[model samples]
Target chain A: QKEVEQDPGPLSVPEGAIVSLNCTYSNSAFQYFMWYRQYSRKGPELLMYTYSSGNKEDGRFTAQVDKSSKYISLFIRDSQPSDSATYLCACKINTGTASKLTFGTGTRLQVTL
Target chain B: SAVISQKPSRDICQRGTSLTIQCQVDSQVTMMFWYRQQPGQSLTLIATANQGSEATYESGFVIDKFPISRPNLTFSTLTVSNMSPEDSSIYLCSVDGGSDTQYFGPGTRLTVL
Candidate 1:
């Protein structure tokens, strides 16, 4: 099984609506979690970051991590058309040495007007 | 966040040819990584490029297939050798000094047709 699993969602929602995206993992050793946004032809942009299991809020975006369930979430309030992109959840595992970030299958989001 | 600049933003290469993608960071970092994102798939780690040392490849990835070079702390290169149609994908480079928070580069979109 893959270390991280995320839905490749063509999740469509209307503008001004709230959006919730999630990912689940099997590795209990993961210590850090992050959410990245990517445009059609650009790189993945860092949106939110959380270490351990907690909730971190930045602007209209919130990131939640549940270490007990190995689940992570990204919530966006008041979505916009420009918000349409791919959302990627990454987990970092520090094996007492160099750390590596394991990524999940990105979820494609489309916000309509 | 670091400003990461990648060269040859997009390329169309012929099968059996090799292309080297370059990533440059404005700030020096100790951790550099190379990843491949196939169509509709999650990002798969190719290798970790450590300055002044041979890159460490992940399972199912080899140095021969995707040779990586990190001659310094601010720059790294990943070469896709003997490319095939299956090799066409977006190749991304990321870096993080010690924070689990990683910053990604504007990926190089490669088309092997």
Candidate 2:
């Protein structure tokens, strides 16, 4: 099985709607969780980051992590057309020596007027 | 967040040719990573480039296919050898400054045909 799994969703939403993006991981050693937003033909930008199992809120976006369930989520309020992009979940682990990041298949979101 | 500059932002090259993408960071970092993002897919790590040593590649990637060079802390290069149509993707470089949080480059869009 892959280390991280995410739904490949081409989710379409209307403006002002709420959007939820999620990912699940099989590794228990993951400690740092992150969500990235990527527009077409550009690099992925960091959206939200969380350490361990907790919830972090940044403006209109919120990130939640469940270490017991090995799941993480990103919630966006009042979605806009500018919010249309691919959302990716990534996990980082430091094995006490070296650290690396593993990312999931991105979820595509489109907010229409 | 560190500013990253990548050369040859977008290029269309013939198959069997090689393309070297350069990544430069504003600040020196301990570890740098190379990633590949195919069309409509999430990013996949190619290798970890550390100065004064050979690059460490991931499971499905190899040194010959994606040769990496980290001559210094602020600069790195990833060369796609004998590019194929399957190699056409957006290549990104990242740096982790001991905080476990990574910042990405603008990315090099390679279109192999």
Candidate 3:
């Protein structure tokens, strides 16, 4: 099984709606969770990251992690057309070195007017 | 956050040909990573490059196929040797940001025809 699993969603929503993207993992050693936004033909941009199993808020986005359940979530409030993109969730373990990240199949979100 | 740039933002190469993608960071960093993002798939780590040391590749990746050079802390290069249609993917480089975060560079999109 893949260490991280996310829905490959082409989820479409209206502007000003609330969007929630999620991912699940099976690795208990994962110590950090991150959310990345990737536009077409562009690189993944780190939106937010959280180490503890709680919610971290930045602007209109919120990242939540539940270590016990191995679940991660990103919530976007008042989604806009400019917010249309693929969202990727990544998990990492503290390996005392440059640790690699395990990424999930991104969820593609489109916010329409 | 580190500002990263990649050379040859997009390329079209013939099968069996090789292409080297260069990654440059605004500041010096300790760890640099190479990843492959296939169509509609998640990102898979190719290798980790550390200055003054041999690159450590992940499972299913080999130095002969994706050789990496880390001549300095701010620059690295990854060469895809003898490319094939299956090798067509977006190649990205990332830097290890302290506190378990990573910053990715604008990816190099390669199409092997």
Candidate 4:
């Protein structure tokens, strides 16, 4: 099984709505979690990062991690049309050296007016 | 966050040909990596590029097919050799941002026909 699993969602929502994206993992060794936003034809940009299990809020985006369940989530509040993009969740087993990221199959979100 | 840039943002190459994608970072970093994202799939790590050493590739990825170069701390390159239609994918270069965080560049979209 893949280390990380996420719904390949082409989820459509209207503007000003709340968008929720999630992912699950099987690796209990994973200690670092992150959320990335990718636009069409562009690479992913880091949006939120969390260590271990906790909730982190940045602007309108909130990232939550539950290590016990190996589940993570990202919530976008008051979504806008420009917020439409692919959201990826990545996990890493925090080693001293460069930690390789294991990513999920990204959820595609479209916020329409 | 480290600013990363990639050359030849998008390319259409013929099967059996090769394409080299360059990645440059705004600042020096010791940890750099290469990844591949196939259509509708998660990002898969290709290799880890460490300056002054040969790149370490992940499982299923080989140096012969995707040779990587890390000449210095701030620059790296990934070359897809003898490309085929199955090799068509988005290639990304990322640098570790400490604490398990990575910053990705504007990916190189490759289409091999």
- Compare the candidates by DockQ and give the number of the best one: 4
Q: Say which candidate scores most in lDDT.
A: 3
Error of 3 at B50 (Å): 0.3
**DockQ leaderboard ranking:** 4, 3, 1, 2
Inter-residue clash pairs, candidate 2: none
Clash list (residue pairs), candidate 1: none
Question: Considering only chain A, what is the TM-score of each predicted structure?
Answer: 0.95, 0.95, 0.98, 0.97
In candidate 1, position B32 carries an lDDT of 91
Query: How do the residues A9-101 of candidate 3 rate in per-residue lDDT, one tens digit apiece?
Result: 999999999999999999999998999999998999999988999899999999999999999999999999999999999999888976789
Per-residue error (Å), model 4, residue A57: 0.9
Candidate 4 TM-score, C-alpha based = 0.97
Candidate 4, which segments miss by more than 4 Å at Cα? none
* Each model's fraction of native contacts: 0.77, 0.56, 0.87, 0.90
Against the reference, the lDDT scores of all candidates come to 0.91, 0.89, 0.96, 0.94
The model with the greater DockQ, 1 or 4, is 4
Q: Give the per-residue lDDT digits (tens) of candidate 3, residues B17-109.
A: 999999999999999999999988999999999999999999999999999999999999999999999999999999998888899999999
Encode model 2's per-residue lDDT on A1-113: one tens digit a residue.
Answer: 88999998999999999999999999988899989998877888888788868889998999999999999999999999999999999998876445677999899999999
Estimate how well candidate 1 is docked, as a DockQ score.
0.80
Better of 3 and 4 by TM-score: 3
Summarize candidate 1's per-residue lDDT along B14-113 as a digit string, tens digits.
9999999999999999889898988888888888888988899999998899998888889999999999999999999998745567788999999999
TM-score of each: 0.96, 0.95, 0.98, 0.97
Q: Per-residue lDDT of A1-113 in model 1, one digit per residue for the tens?
A: 98999999899999999999999999888888989999999889988888868899998999999999999999999999999999999998766456688889999999999
Candidate 3, A110: how far from true, in Å? 0.2
